[model samples]
Target: MTTDVIVVGGGHNGLTCAAYLAAAGLKVTVLERRIVVGGAAVTEEFHPGFRNSVASYTVSLLNPKVIRDLELPRHGLKVVERKMANFLPLDGDHFFVGEGRTQAETARFSQKDAERLPAYWDRLDAIADVLRELVIQTPPNLVEGGLKEAIPELIKSAVIGRKLSRLDLTAKRDLLALFSQSAGDWLDGWFESDPIKAAYGFDGVVGNYASPYTPGSAYVLLHHVFGEVNGKKGAWGHAVGGMGAISGAMAACCRERGVQIRTDTAVAEVLTEKGRATGVVTASGETLKARAVVSNLHPQLLFQKLVGPGVQPADFVERIARYRSGSATFRMNVALSDLPRFTVAPEPGDHMTGGIIIAPTMAYMERAYDDARVHGWSKAPIVEMLIPSTLDDSLAPAGRHVASLFCQHVAPELPGGRSWDDCRDEVADLMIATVEKHAPGFAASVLGRQVLSPLDLERTFGLVNGDIMHGRLSLDQLFSARPVLGAGDYRTPVKGLYQCGAGTHPGGGVTGAPGHNAAAEILRDVRRRRI
Candidate 1:
């Protein structure tokens, strides 16, 4: 079979790219290995009567342009913002940050921190605005090259420079520090209260397998805030039908544009001729030909596993090999018999609908990371619980609920030759026990549970070593240097083989910017007959 473009992996980004390509009048086909599409953003039934977003839970960072252009709302996508932002339970106290309540919340601990909250938001908002603009645009090649090859890159550099130039000196300083400093240090400079710092610091380690004090963590913290929910900047919300609803809507949009999606068809190899990607060989031994091939798989998996050896440059191969992957993430979905009653905030309120964090301070977060690095999993693990069923009733049985437990500080690969398969249940119990400490009856309320170890995450969703952001969001692996310096523009060294995954510029989350930016580049190449 033949098509204008063959998109490998029917993840949300691949679906988004296919939609755009088909809209441009190209015949596009998407191949997915799983029985269903959406990749890690899918919702599944983990228990007899409990269904929840399996991998990626919560909603934010989905590009509005993709939603608007694809008309996802018309395809039945609905996202509602959380009434509160975060609920942090202290030893005998609680802190909550919601609309019009952050000041009062901070004042409950420190009056000085309450007054400084506005300045912190103003500074963070300024830096986020700069990154928000950059996320949708392709990163320019910063490495020196031949003059003829350098002209377009230089132009792109100038465009990016102009955007950065908008920032004043103070804003520039703040931006640079975020890219270089630790989240703990950065928050210490702005706030005094432990609960306030811990609430904001949690973003620094969400998909990142690092401590809050780890360098470049401030950037990870910054990465999470650039997203908005329902047009509200930095506000996180729940998709009415779980996270899968977003991808389902995108798939619908793709189908409407004449894109063909084939599930359970895995690509065994990328068929390249004379350094140009021509097509792919399926796992079933059928060869599907195409003018261009787009990969939404992780860069390491695509280049090392699928793309044949000796096809990529030696330097490029080495870079892809050395490209860091993996997260300290251990995910779980619980079928709760009833709501968890917190010790500090027992009464039912809007906080129950938002993120309930178990990490109470920056010190607690650091200890969790340090413990996991050596022991494979944190003894007192950090966990963020979100009860989506509280906001969306369709996910569970009447009066019962489903909650996503995004636990952290587990080693990507265990030490002492221990396998995650052996200890998966034990660690899951530890996570549940940790929550029980904060909410007395949380353990007994769990009617059932589905656990995904770091290894399980890698095997199940193809998130290499469980790195949900595709690759680490470190300074060395971001922007022009992502995946590697030469391959940052979504165009691989092998012509016609492009990357539209989270490993590219803007990096991770449910955001379709990589796919959006990649389609523009691929279309440009098609217009020039480069593909």
Candidate 2:
């Protein structure tokens, strides 16, 4: 059947694009290679009656426009807001973090930080206001289209002028420091406690290949802090039934709006006609035609594998060739008989809503990165643990909890030719051993565990080289330089095609801005065709 649009994946981004396009009365069809929808944002009953989201742990950055556009809340999606932000555990039972709706909980760590918290919020609010303005507008492109592009250039400049007016000189300096410094350096300047430093530092390296000590790692922390649920900063929540519930609801919205989805149908190739993307060919030798083809996969996967050679510009292909997104993050899911007992906080409730950062100090985290730089996996890896079953009962049998562990400091493509198949179990053991330092008897609680290295992640979720964020959120690779140095405006060189995934403008982590902007671009393109 001919369709108005054909999306090559059923991830949240693809479903998002399909839903919006279908909502606009355009017939859209999405093809997912997975058995279920939601590429990374998926939940599965891997352990028979125990459901857990194998990839993409939390949900705070999903754009609210998606919720309103797809009416997600009305369609069986309940975003359960966790009360606590996160908990950092040290060797001597000292745990410190930011929590509660007010400053008192923050004051428990540093009275001065408690007092400065409101000021920080106000500052971040002002910066966020600037970021929101930037997020909505198209990222500027220097050398696109003809001379008439001056009008868009002028409008973008005006937006910048207005944004600059919102910040004072001091605020500008503060914003720069917040985005440029290391999270450990910035937090250490404010808080004396190592646990407090590590708690905030964890955000810097969450989805990136860098360590907490990396020069621009603080920007990642800022990126996460910019997202809010109900206007509260740094608060992350989970959708009931696992992260997959989010994409499922989006797919349902698409279906109700006349969008068709086909699962387990992998696209073997992207059919191109005269340098424009036309549609795709499935692995089973079936072909579907469409006016506009949208790919939600990483640019590497799309251009390097699916889309054949000679259609893309030689230079563009080279940039994709050089793009670096290889990371050794292991997304490990386990069925636990019960919540693992923490040596420090024995009470189950203490660690229920939040994650436990295994790295106790800044030095320890740096050492983990050092280990990755030298030995492949960390001697003592940094692990973040979440018990999703504590909040959502549908995830597991009664009294049983499911744990999702995000571990890092292992290289995805090691130089020594050590494949993932040989390293996965050792990586899992390393993660459990690190967690065991804080959560005693953690090894025993696991009834069944599934470990995924970068190669495994690439096989499962199609994340390029297991880099979950699509590409590193490096300073050069972000903003206008994302994915490539000059293609951040969602417009690829190929006509009738645009990008709208984590690999685009705002980087990654469940944010729907890339998809939203992509749809808006296509709609604008359609309108221009009439003019």
Off by over 4 Å in 2: 96-98, 101-115
Per-residue alpha-carbon lDDT of model 2 for 1-531, expressed as tens digits? 678888888888888888878877778889999988889998887787788888998888887766787898878788877756676666666464545533664556567767776776677677776776566457776565576865776677777777877799877887788768887777776677555567667888887677787888888888877676755555788789998888878877888888899999999998889888888899999989888888888988888998876888898899999888965598899889888777777786745677767877778878888888788888888888888887788899998889899998778787688788987898888888888777788888888887889889999999888999898877777877877866777767777667778888787888777778778777777778721
lDDT of 2 at 345: 76
lDDT of 1 by residue, 1-531 (tens): 899999999888998889999999999999999998999999899999889999999888998888898899999999999999899988999999899999998998999999999999999999898889899998997655688778888899999899899999999999999999999999999988898999999999988888999999999999999999878898999999898998899999999999999999999999999989999999999999999999999999999999987888898888899999878899999999999999999988899999999999989999999999899989999999999998999999999999999999899889999999999999999999999998999999999999999899999889999999999999999998888998899999888999999999888899988999999999989998998
lDDT of 2 at 393: 87
Window of ten residues with lowest summed lDDT in model 1: 141-150
- Candidate 2 C-alpha error for residue 363, in Å: 1.4
Q: What would the TM-scores of all predictions be?
A: 0.99, 0.95
Single out the weakest 10-residue window by summed lDDT for candidate 2.
Answer: 94-103
Prediction-by-prediction clash tally? 0, 0
TM-score of 2: 0.95
